[model samples]
Target: MLKLKSPQKATMQITRWVSDLDWRLLLLIIPSLSVLVFLSLSSTPIDSFPSLRSFIFNHTLLTSNSPDFVNSLPSGVHNRRESSVAKWKDELLRSRMAVCLVGGARRFELTGPSIVENILQVYPNADLFLHSPMDRNAYKFSLLKMAPRLASVRIFNPKPLNETESQVRVLTAANSPNGIQGLLQYFNLVEGCLQMIETYQKRKNFTYDWIIRTRVDGYWNAPLGPENFIPGQYLVPPGSDYGGLNDRLGIGDLNTSKVALARLSLIPKLDSAGFHQLNSETSFKAQLTTQHVPYLTKRVPFCIVTDRRYGFPPSRFGVPVAALSSPGPLSGAKCRPCTAACQGRCVAGVMRSLYKGWSWTDWDNGSLELCNARDQWERGWEKIFDKVAGKKSASVRKKFADLKKKECVDDFNEMKKRVSNWEAPPPEELCGLGLAV
Candidate 1:
């Protein structure tokens, strides 16, 4: 039926069939071959293959033994970063710094020498500007004669502040014992100092590179280190948020200082933002955020020295007063001189139980000691302060205690002479507040 093909013809047909099969196999394997070549030549690792990288790395890390893979990196990597930071901080030392000290010199005898020894002396080139409401205790501010560069001084009589409707509406009267009027007056005191700085800068035809806003009564256990002077950000102490920034201490360049110190002027802005029942700290934070300025917070080695009384083993919403002698940076925590009733584990448990957003600080590490602040500063607290404050600071306390009225007036006159601008009620009214003629 069919003629048989010749042997040669049959062989050629078989060869043709083999060639066609090879072509079909090549088509199927070419894609996989290309992918293999691409991966082999890639600059990135196999784990970074674009599609599976994130999923792969995450799963690998979870199954791995190491929890801190980044920190487990070589020490040299961290050391270089630290070295760069140190170099940057060294450059900040050359910038001009202005120390703007505000608030009353209520316990200047206790707080003054420390300021001189810590802040003013720490930055010998920085000029001192003191703005305080005149009080009987203000005579103690005469110790500022020790400051190397005294610039401006304004110790004025406290008069009622003319409150704007905005100020009344924005500020809260609850925590403020002096009521809404007291808030206005206090705001005037802080903002008034800012005005002094502005006027001084304009008169001199030069602006400060930095402005340090601090209270008169803050006790610093350490120096105002150059680390606080960040170039583009305002610096404030950490903790004690109290629904806002810790307004107790702030450091910034001139522009930031202007905004921060515009305490009274910013009230209208707060009102516009519909903020009410705002305390000092809350309002301070609002002003900065609304203005779009950046700020940074770190643990500072200073605390607000206080004479106000608080309940011992404070309940929630109660303030825990620290002892002055407690080894602390304090960081603006309320403190007074007294025999410590709580220390070690007692302080830790109390601080731990309290709200971190409210009156809490680094109380562990023996940095805090609790006082039975249910009463006034304990009798003979001065002796306790002297023993802890060291010799140089203690000598200052004695000098103020023994100063007579005429001597006080003479000292203030000398202070006035040193200051570039002097604004106050008068030398006699100043001396008569604290000294008996």
Candidate 2:
């Protein structure tokens, strides 16, 4: 098989091998040239390819339901939020609103101005109805003179309530330290304001489109917007459910509010429905549910400002009081001011341990700061509140703290002149409770 070939035959074979190698190389090069030509003709910029990939990657990262991602959203995302709020504001301008504020005015000096600016002034057409018990801190409410509209104001002395049989049977004294009498008084405060609204409506021959119920002790960091006004459903704040909807702040159409605000009148219905041992919030839910009323919840930008003390590093059943300066839409949770003992992972661990149906609030966004709250409000809290609440709000606080009895009486007189119904004690009695003789 190892036979030698002639020189001319070997030359011919080598040439054919060289020609086959060239054709194979051409086959590989032609496809690449075609691709390059196609790209060029399509006018695709070389830099644009990576940009397209980056855009998709960023969008996916942002849209994922990660808490961290949602908290630290991109700036463009904020623009979209601003746009939505603007739309909501426009709708609010068209609606007639009533704001019913209840509870004692313990910290109205700190809370009043913000309520005026963020709520009443924002809705200039809104009618404000105030129902509160007279107390040494009552003079602080003089700051409400800044409100754009005043419908009715009542500041009454605390009186012993005769708890009805139905109230005793339906309500629980377990969490209410003041017992059944406390529940009766609170129910009276809410329903009394509703009564004022009805009388005013009857006088004017026109009804409000919306009714808002909030607390006098509530400190609002932001304006209440129109998104809370659902046409068919009552709206309440999201957390501290206590086996029911949060009754600290509520908003609804007039029809829905009639059902929501009838606190005392609904007890008989609750009794018939076999609901018992219910706290305020639970009773509220029962009343609505039994009436076939629908409700929705959203996070509101306010806290139930408090001076009460709770234990530090709270137990599972204990309440976690937030710091006043904490950047939170506290949503009606109890709060006070102090150096924070918990945040981030510590907060998550503590919140997870607590009952969500009880004292829990939205703590994942780093918006909440915990306070030891083992003691009363610390010294120089005024300065701290002033710094965080801005100069305008601080000025309001200072004015009220320095309010004299005479000035307080004059302000009450002015408030009396403004309201259609002023069913309260005389200005002297109202202001004297707070002012030193």
Candidate 3:
């Protein structure tokens, strides 16, 4: 360097000085170089220039947007995720239903068997709530093993409770403004069903899809098909409307159920809503109409084999005519060839009395008749269950006995076939000789 060095030698000497720098100093220099490179790349906006800061910022923003990242961000973010997930789960599980079974426990041996066999058996997924005031024979009736799913409350024994007991048991008031016994009992039945819904919701963390309220004493003359489950509406029997909805068989979503269940409270609402002189059936109708709940009526394959008696030519407002001798694989609403004791022209007229805007011409006259079963039952109906139940042959008798024990009448295989074919047995076969009332 003292002598005038060449340009190449001077360049080599500068390089050597850089190479001789300490490792720690070099490490510090590397970061300084990186920063310079980053700044240069960022400032120079070329079409192909890769900017480290821009790339890093974009990746960081994307990570922040991700659920996993959001969940991990902080305590606040994690809590938010948990809350959102919980809400979603609750919404997913929310459903509407409240099954209610009412009336006296008369004919429970026959009716109970049919319910467990046909209706309840097929709807294993359903909630089965019962409200019959049990009689002395209640203990004799075969309680279905599956009943616990719907009846956590004690089976209603129709005994009069003391004032304190009544007060404790009374959950809702009757829809009747006057609070008649029938209406009060009905209210209690509905209340029990509501309690069931609440208990089920709490225990299982799920709600119902629909509540099917029917009588325990009803004998299913046929299967309870899935077609009955109408969307956003309640369903009931056709001929029993009586200017109101049939409370006997109610298929309702939760909203309808809520209005239907609020017995005493519902009356004031109905009154405020401008309704008057509502009977049980009419009140049911008012409840639906006032709450804007829609309903449908279909023939279910069953009848309320009543204890009452009426003449062949029924009074103008007489009891319904049902066939004593029916060979029914009856579609719940098919009343073909039916004769009426009421003042109506045909079964359609009977149905119209109960349900407005009902078209009953579709009823099958040949398939059904309205005969009084109470008289027959009182005479020798014990033989009827034995005969139809096929008590003769070992295999047939065994099957019948099995059905009796299980309380399930619609054999799954037979049900499947009927559903597939949509072919019901002829009324003649259902009503003739051995099948007759």
Candidate 4:
């Protein structure tokens, strides 16, 4: 109906229309092309993808230390990967380690030499950090003079800590001897050692690859092997879990250890997670899980040397005590050096009666022997300890029992000489902690 447009204008309009249509077509076609390419790539079998398979198997040693992981691999592949395994083990031995000892020196005379012999000397290069409360037993720590290296030692007089409302809501005093306050004190002891390690690292301008934390009251039956130093995971001894993970004897890389070692500092995080009425063990487990840290459990060759008594023929919730003579890596179970009260089928029957997660440990075969720890350590517990702990450890016990202030001062002085950080009271003050004024 209108005047006819020029041929050049009409041609230009047609050209613009064609360009828009081509772009719309491309939008529809490109996605389909991409889908087809993805389908084609995904159809290729993983076994045929040599580069992918090689990456998983080759880099595993740098990442994984789980024996379960190795066993899960193809049978023949494990044998071919032996060299990788050896290399990881070698790395563990050479890695810098911080061996942190925490708790009161209640049984330092008996436990100290074993720790020095099995843990400290076994990893002679590892620096030692000890944080303990000053008690009548504080003088016993003089045994640490035998330790090859002492990085830090803190012996402070303990005062009652003020409890927060969150601590009251989140913690339970059910099984603790000192109630919630007891747990707080123990937590402080552990966390304090971590603070010391941090200070030492800053002072020296170096980071430890691994941190090994154990109680001062623990008696080691064997050396802490290189296998326990998992690269990215926290290692804990199995069993004795009361609705949570074992809080005793933890080993890990510095990152994981930081979370594991912050026993007291992480309680607020637990409260935030809605954890209520948790005991130390449960609180400890909650701390790790809340922080998204991974942990693994293995049988460690140490037992807590406790003077506290537990019921024999333990009920569903009762604690089972072990005899030190048991040919075992007892894994931090409460133990005493005494004649076995239960063994063979007697042990099997009693152990079977107890809940595995609550109070029981792996006591299969003839590996475990029980103690009648109900009463005070039998009248002559010294001989029993000596007989089980051997002549060398026995001699150490005698030396501590007969310790003089002069000798204690001399011993601490010697230990101080080897230490890199001596953050403790003077040797004379430490030696005379329990002596009468």
Candidate 5:
């Protein structure tokens, strides 16, 4: 047992030990190297990486889903994203697109110019469609004159929709501000935009490759980036899913868009399937599911800017209102400007308290801020708005806030000159109703 080894024998023994160490290292490092290589090669289109994409896009919770990982990517992944986005933009440039805006112009004075600059101008080739109901504040829509293009504009006073038996059975009156009647009116506006697009295609003997349906009250903080144009998927903003997908904004190719925009026409189909008591969001999910449309969710760069009051530290069933300045796409969350009533750990506590399946939004990584909306928007909401929106947008807001009947009429006239397929009541009537003496 105490025998000493010869020099050559000891050397051979040491070489064997070194060889064993190398094998162990290879066993440990091989897997990690494979993973690194796989990730690096995943620079193809989204369709190329179905397994990884499928992982991010969960099966339950209303179809497929994915988050915008734009901010958190490593430098290589970030560059890859830019390359992917460039490809999307290239496809868009070679296609026809329609950008539809629906609903009332409640806060349009503040929201309109941003739409013109951020969306309409950004996709200057995409035709614009405006379908809004006439209201006392309708004069504010005159701001859309700055739009790069217009396919159609219909600002009409809505007659009450006769809620069919199917509508009554399927759609509940709860949570709707104006009840089932209100839902119908909103649905009509959404569907009406599709109808208008169809009519335009018929008139011009052409078809659109893409349809982007958004709201009139939505404010855009940045451009609707090219990355969202998934060929086979309907893209809706993430969060604010009130027992349904966010209906606030939708983007899709022509085939998927039809299934989405057919809000009213699909109700009969929903009723046939024995679905009832559905809210707008739930009904939206049902429509797409039944139609076999695949959908994707990404953080869109817009918010439904609202003046409606909501409670702070939103209760289990209550709505969480975001501050306009919250560095969010806000993703269709109702937002208003005020000193944040909640943020940081406060946001964490409040978000935890909310029903995640209900009116919850993404509040991670300090991307969200809250507004105390129990009362009216703060007394100096203008100053707060101007500060958040910066000088260029604030000047546009001031222009509309100071809009007179004469100036409003002038703007409409200018729009009439530029807009193709303009379909609406006269400028005088539109201005007259909103600015009556």
Candidate 6:
């Protein structure tokens, strides 16, 4: 039998040999040997080669034995599956529809222009249903000619009735069947909206993917971005959640519409569910919660312009007086066109004092101002309007030219850009109380 050298002696001999060899040649030979050994080891089958199998098995044990491996793998799988499900649901819900219900006096005059110019124009794909107690003045909204489809415009001649009488009239007529008197009045409005969807769907042979419900007199301050649509959730403005969802804005799949439009009827379900004396907002919130419906709130860009007035130092019991000159296309809530007594620092202070949880968001850091335009429209409001209009209107074009000749072009342009980009400082910024974005 040939005698093999001991391990230590063998290693010493190899080291001495390497030390004597050309360094470059030794480096090349070492890497080449490493590659050959790796291939030979890898090619050996597990069962046939005990040493190689042991090496691989030890590596496998090291990796699989890690506590994090078991913990993380399941979590990764779950997240991936959840992501896939959400993607599928979003795609399925993309074809939904929206319904805008417009009722009340001066619906056209106060809100029609802005709706036509901003919302309806931008969202041409949306269906518009007008249910107003008609007045001859409704004719003034020829601009609404652009609506993709207009559902029935019911013109009920509302007799001057007290609050109780009006409520009863509205409720009874909304419930009536054929004579357009009771529940039918409300049903007509709801059905008219549904019919618009049905007509469009039948014409296209498809169902709408989503529906949005909003009031006619609600003026929009910003573009309604598509990001507002959340799957499996109805969305409304935050402050207006009045207990249920804000009856003002509702966005959901067809499944939600069936429950939401049964407004008067839902009251019984609410009362049956142990709800009592619920106000409009609260009742709306109850309907969703009781039905196990999910909902979300976003800051919708609108203001319900009201005409009610309250004294300064607004009594803890004082009603909030919103300015009509409130940089809005004023949808008819109620508004007074008077100069904001609460300007500059005072405006910032009042906005800060507002109950954020109940009223408005951080008031954009107090930059919001109420232009009480009831007593008088502000002096420079026309100029401000002209600046914002830019080349959109011929009148604005003329105004811009006159201002340019007066050497106010730079200042005007700066202000116009700020408004255009919505970069105006929040009320807090103007007051130097907080950082402005």
As for TM-score, the candidate ahead, 2 or 6, is: 2
lDDT of 1 at 346: 92
> What are the clashing pairs of model 5?
244-281
lDDT for each residue of candidate 3 in 1-437, tens digit (9 for 90 to 100): 13213322332343464457653454467565445444444434453232233233222232234445565456764675456545533432354434566656555555666676666656555555554454433332333433423433334434442333222233223443434555656667676667666666777787766777777666675656544554455667765555555566666566566666766556656666666555677777777777866565655667665555444433454444455344543323222122223322554555444323221212345444455322433444455455543333223324333343122322322332322121222223211212122
lDDT of each: 0.76, 0.78, 0.49, 0.81, 0.80, 0.46
Best candidate, TM-score: 5
**Per-residue CA lDDT of candidate 1, range 64-156, in tens?**
212254365357744654565466455655667788898888888778878888888877878888999888888877778788888899988
Give each model a TM-score: 0.80, 0.81, 0.55, 0.81, 0.84, 0.54
lDDT of 2 by residue, 1-437 (tens): 21213322332333354345543354355465335434433455454343333222222322222455445556676566456556757767777889999999888887888788888988998999999998888877777888999998888888998887888899999888698888888989999889989999999999998899988888888987655666656888888888888999888889889999999999999999999999998999999999977676777889988888888777787788988777777898898656677888888888888988887888867988888788888887787788878999988778776778999889888888888888788889878877885
Quote the lDDT for 200 in model 4: 95
RMSD to the native, candidate 1?
17.9
Candidate 2 local lDDT, residue 342: 84
Ordered from best to worst lDDT, the candidate numbers read 4, 5, 2, 1, 3, 6
Q: List runs of model 2 lying over 4 Å from the truth.
A: 1-87
Q: Kindly state the number of residue pairs that clash in model 4.
A: 0
Give candidate 4 misplaced runs (Cα > 4 Å). Answer: 1-89, 435-437
Per-residue lDDT of 201-277 in model 6, one digit per residue for the tens? Answer: 67667666667776665655555545455545566776533223455677666666656555555555665667654
Each prediction's RMSD to truth = 17.9, 19.2, 25.9, 15.0, 11.6, 22.4
Worst 10 residues of 1 by lDDT: 54-63
Candidate with the larger TM-score of 3 and 5: 5
- Per-model clash counts, in order, read 2, 0, 31, 0, 1, 49
lDDT of 2 at 373: 85
Runs with alpha carbons beyond 4 Å of true place in candidate 3: 1-98, 146-151, 157-179, 327-363, 372-378, 389-437
Query: What C-alpha lDDT, on a 0 to 100 scale, does residue 246 get in candidate 4?
Result: 92
- Candidate 5 per-residue lDDT, tens place, 1-437, comes to 21213322332343354345543364465465446435544444544443333222222112212343344445675675567557757778778999999988888888887888888888889999999888877888888878887788888877988879999999999989989998898899999999999999999999999999999989888888776776667889878888789999999889899999999999999999999999999999999999988787888778888778877668998899998889887888998878888989999999999998788888888989998889998889899889988898899888776677898899999988887677677888888887753
Query: What value of lDDT does candidate 2 attain over all alpha carbons?
Result: 0.78
